[model samples]
Target chain A: MTDYSPLLLSLKVAGISTFFVFIFGVFFAHLFSRKKFFGKSIIESLFMLPLVLPPTVVGFGLLILFGKNGFIGSWLLNWFDFQVVFTWIGAVIASIVVSFPLMYQSAAAAFESLDARMENAARTMGASNWRVFWTISFRLAWPGLLAGLVLSFARGLGEFGATLMLAGYIPGKTDTIPMAIYFAVESGQMEKATFWVVIIVALGFSTIMWLNWWSRRNIERYKNDNA
Target chain B: MLEVQIKKKLPHFLVDINLTVEDEILVLVGPSGSGKTTILNAIAGLDHPDDGRITLNGNIFFCDNEKPLPTQQRNIGYLFQDYALFPHMTVEKNIAYGVKKMNAIEAEKRIERLVNTLGINHLLSKYPHQISGGEKQRVALARALATEPSLLLLDEPLSALDSRTRLECQEELQRLHATWKTPFIIVTHDMQEAEKLGDKIIFLESGLITKTVDNRSGKMIC
Candidate 1:
């Protein structure tokens, strides 16, 4: 008998986490790319921390922050009797924290490459700041932004360490594909573990293939439109 | 009338200029780094003058004591040296961009008139990267004029075109000016272009006007 709860849970967690990551990632990317102020480098570096930190390190940090007696954990326990630790919400948070930098880096690079003169031309022609961003900057940066979207979604889908630390393995509740695979192997259920490994590899491969096809199609459409 | 009296410090020298133009072309001719584009940028509110006042037809654009009017509200049409056409947009879309305040019918009518006037009717559907340099220049000009700005500034408007296209575009520019009759301030390094297009030419060096030539009267005014 095959259980599909882990697959469904993994997709739900990644989908939710990617949604939040996209909004914050693009927003912060634009802010960091366009504006300059105090402590900008430090703040940007902090955002990039999860990318370089070992998975266990990230998981350990999340544990410290969300563990009972921790600041947010204690407050949540006292207020709503709701604990994020060992729950689906914890998995979403962990995925977001781990996958954020991928989106941020791609979006920032996209924005940084935009020609300032084109933006200035829009401004002199009486386009508002908001209009310029939407019509010009965002449109021009779409390709790179789309790449970030795929990378972050994939990262979120594969998130394991932080999820394991925060959202423990519980069948039909917190058991995601990665958690299921790990436990199945530890318990000598090689067939189940192999099944999950194959599924994850196929998912990752298809995601990347879709991104490439989408990018090429977009470029072709752009050229055809111009022609 | 466009009035400019501004001072700004540059890396090499201080740019100090006081000039005015009314329904005529005023050309700033100088060496590469003599702050010609800087003056145009200041007038367009793209860059600030460290100290001074700029008024277009009596509306204040910038003053030391008052907050500078943002570029969006300045109603100044600037044709950049590189044309600065939006690559992703078609020629017609680029021209129509600055005229969003008008209803679709009126905006379409305006765009039609501009493309016809600039002879870019054939290239309306083409994007910036797909057009020739001359076509790009004409499209950019149409865009600048789309808003019916009270003042027009050109920064090396013909520098990128070949000699043949440059000559043709220069004549087209004069014809457009005659029809529009707004204040025109053009920056150029070519003395011949200054003579051809300018009613008043100011020769600048190290950020100061070294000489002034009234091209209409052919009189030297130092």
Candidate 2:
């Protein structure tokens, strides 16, 4: 029988990482969309590095920054008795770093597409900037924002190379589905590898299908609204 | 009284204008890019001027040397040409948006009164997308007036309507102005619209007030 611990671990890590990425991604997207300053492109490019670089390269960079005796890792270990390397937390961190760009890009596009006049109208109606964002901007951009979240969750679920490099495979602990599949194939357990592959493919496919349906529904609604 | 003596430097021209308005319909008649909308924006605190002061009902709204009060605190209502209603909110909620500081009962009463006054009582539950252009304009007007602003600015308010609807909307505006007695500054390029609705019309050319026509007497005042 194939152990499902890898699946459970993968879910936990992806769920938590997606949540964090959602919040930070939306905040950064709003910031970048509304404000302009010097070196803005450089800062945006830095956030997008993980999307262009190899997953293993991202993992290697994370390891250098968070490994024991590393600057942040040493401080965390000494002050909080915390260790992220070779643990599920490391997997979550890797997932967050890799999936953030997707969320940010999607949210930014949605925000930029919104009419600034709507926001100005809200302000003239005595709505504060914070209130305008929540009641007007966020509401208008929700469909795209939701699409971003789903994409990030899918990306996090399929995260492999970074998870493997940073949070080394350890069955029932840090071993996620992707890592489990790798080890199963290496050990000649074709059935186990195939099972894991099927589950991942099904989850990924459903998410993409749902996203497509949602986008189509949004387009139809917009057409009907204008018509 | 609303008093404005402001200069704003645009890319191609300098807007230097001095104007005063009372509890009457003051129309700004000018071509596109003649600074009519910019004047409204400056009063609404949506645009800043290079130098000048704006005062309404003894309250200073903007001064070039000091940080201008933000738009929300200006107590000025603006009706955009497109009737910029919040698409996600119901008509009632949009009307009640700026009146959140009022007690629930008071807010409800205020919304009911405005909706009834605007003949939009039936549209209270409908979203902006579900309403017609004329209905949306009424809803936008109701939302703008719900806060009890000291002054109202209408930017090309009738430009988005068809001829029949525009005539109806102009009559409605006249009725509302007579009843509410709140000062209104309306911008329009149509000379007939200005004559029909404006008590005083200010002709603008190249960001300057070229002439002032008192529509009541059909005589040039300045």
| Candidate 2 lDDT tens digits, A1-227 | 65789889989999999999999999999989999999999999998999999999999988988899888888899999999999999999999999999999999999998878788888887899999999999988998899999999999999999988889998888988899889999999999999999999999999999999999988776453344
lDDT, candidate 1, A49-113, per-residue tens: 99999877898888888889888888889999989999999999999999999999999999998
True contacts kept of 1: 0.73
User: lDDT of model 1 at residue A225?
Assistant: 26
> What are the models' TM-scores?
0.94, 0.96
Per-residue lDDT of B1-222 in model 2, one digit per residue for the tens?
Answer: 999999999988999999999899999999999999999999999889999999998888898789998999988888988877877788888888888674878877877888888899898898888888899899989988888888989999988789999999999999989988989999999999999999999999889999998889989999
Worst 10 residues of 1 chain B by lDDT: B100-109
Docking class of 1: medium
Q: Lowest summed-lDDT stretch of 10 residues in model 1 chain A? A: A218-227
DockQ of each: 0.58, 0.67
